[model samples]
Target: MATIKITTESVAALTKSAVPNKTTFYFDNELAGFGLYRTTTGTGTYFAEFRPVAGGSKKRLKLGRVGTLKANEAREAARRAIANAALGKDLAQNRSDERASLTVEELVSKYIEEYVAEHKKASTAGLYRMLLKKHVKPRLGSIKATSLTRVDVQRAHALMTREARVSANRAIKLLSAAYGWGSRHGHVQEGMNPASGIKLNEEEGRERFLTTAEMLAIGNAMIEAETIGLPVDAGTTKHAPKGQLVVMSPYATAAIRLLMLTGARLREILNLRWSEVDLERGVLRLPDSKTGKKTVFLPTAAVDIIKGLTKLGSYMIAGESAGTKHEKPRSDLKRPWAAICKRAGVNGVRIHDLRHTFASTGVGDQMGLPVIGTLLGHADPSTTQRYAHLADEAARRAVEAIGGKIAAAMNGGK
Candidate 1:
């Protein structure tokens, strides 16, 4: 090692020279222990040599590559390393410890494999995986799990809210759950959930209930889609295949009917197996649902719809390849639903609103809230209370009926 003034020009001149088969070290004459090493291949690296403890062994810390870092920039880093080393701090070991720490990405993988996949429902597990992939992992994956702060979570939540508020809320909750699970299982430090207590974006409740007239229109549209095929949208058919029409599959049509009549969730109907459906007993025994092992009682109309559908392998709502070696449940009824809604002239109503419609219809017919709650498979009675206004309307009708009967009897006696 030779003591020389380390500058950009000096390092450049050394790197440009083709010094073969020998590595040379040049220490800064002005700053002790701060230097650069030029290899036999003409590449250079900046390093700082210091005694980690007073009068103890010397340790070397690599600052950066020659061209990637300026001489002044590297000197400043070396100054900090040397200053920390004088105070008995091992900067090199600190960097190595940071590199070896568990990151948020690894924690998510561990949580998914150990807890989510094992304990959560398949549908829930799938949703959690999607949210983590699309939102959580991309934003915070590289962050060290132990050092994650609530501010970091707040910033991510704020950014995610711009695209999807509901999904943002759910994603944060999922992340919080992962952290809690990690803490319990020793993967994370206790009480260190950065995602906890975030002020989530306000999401409006979607409580659309179809009127009786709308239900009749939808029923008519279903009939047309099943048989003659509903009219295609002229706007969508600009590059049409001659005289193409939108005809829903029989299985899809039945799925919609089941959704309308039984108030079952979309997945519950789509994944319904023949073994779970007992038409004779008028119930669908779902082995696993969002609520776990639920039984949906089918009314006469719902039972008739299921009875009419052909049993294609296991699933009642079969895909096109049902009964084949590649048989599986239909993924979704998005196209069929769009056609039906378009023909019915329904606007801004989701498939989930069909469930609201079923509950509203029951409430309108004077079925008590408890009865409606049981039919909808609501674990909490409060979940069924959204239709309390409709129940109030039913009560008003019953009171009017009693009053009219008493008045009529009194007049006849007169």
Candidate 2:
């Protein structure tokens, strides 16, 4: 080691020199209190070290090769390191400590790998991945988990609300779950969940159902559209829009028809295996339902629809591809249903509303509350009480029938 009267330019020249291994130079400069000397150790590589104090134990740290670390900046850094050492402090330890602090990206990765992947179902896990990828990760992945604030969560929620309220709610729910998992495992400190209180006001009350006139109009339109499409070649189109298929099984049509006619839940109709239908008995056996499995007797018209559908395929509801078992039956009701509704001029009514239509029409027809409940597969009779006007109308009809008899007897006695 040699103590050279050092300047920034002198250190730069020394760092630029070519030599057979690492080199060191002690320099004194106004900008760089300590300067380094380094040279090429092998092809294209060089190393250098610097210390501020001339006679102090060498704090030899590697500086990069000829072109990488610019001479001026390296000299300036060398000066700062020397200055720190003169004050008996280690700059390297401070860098290491800063690097060790937890970042949001690191915590999210650990939470997914350790908690979500291990415990959640494949479908549910996929949903979580989607929520995090679309909503959470972009906003907060780079933030430190321990330092996550309610404001960060609120900002994410506000952005999501512009896209969709339901989706915003789902994103918030998923984020809460992730944070809860972190808290349970001691990754996050105790506090109220930022996502906990946010609520999305969705469209509530009973779903809208199409009326009988609407159903007739829909059916006639589907027939006319098919007649119109007869001239077109099948291969001409790449893909039909949802619910727009031209040809359909009588069974599928009836299944959809019954869905509108009787207002049965889509899953109730779709999940109907051949084993569940008793054509001769006129009773459908639901092994389980949303309200728990109970036997529901089909009305004569509904039974007629079931009989027509029994001929379509092994499954009660058939898909586009015939003679193949659908991984899950009754998956989609695209094209044909859309064509039907389009012809009817009713827009934005979902297939599920067929059941709603059934309930609504029954209520309109003055069916008793208990009868409507049974027809709609409600386990609790009280659930059917919302349509109490139907029962009131039935009671009025009964009184009218008795009143006519009483009037006849009174007239006869007079």
Which candidate number would show the highest lDDT if scored against the true structure?
1
Candidate 1 ranges with C-alpha deviation above 4 Å = 1-100, 231-243
RMSD for each model, in Å, please? 17.6, 20.4
* Clash pairs for candidate 2: 104-143, 242-335, 243-334, 243-335, 243-336, 244-335, 244-336, 245-335, 245-336, 263-355
> What does the lDDT read for residue 378 in candidate 2?
88
The Cα error of candidate 2 at residue 58, in Å, is: 41
**How many Å off is the CA of 14 in candidate 2?**
77
Q: Kindly list the per-residue Cα lDDT of model 2 for residues 135-200, writing each as its tens digit.
A: 777877777776677788888788877877776778777767766655543355433356666655
lDDT of each: 0.84, 0.63
Lowest summed lDDT over 10 consecutive residues: which window, candidate 2? Answer: 229-238
**Tens digits of per-residue lDDT for model 1, 240-331:** 46457756678988999999889999999998889999889899999888777799999899888888888778788888778999787898
lDDT of 2 at 275: 82
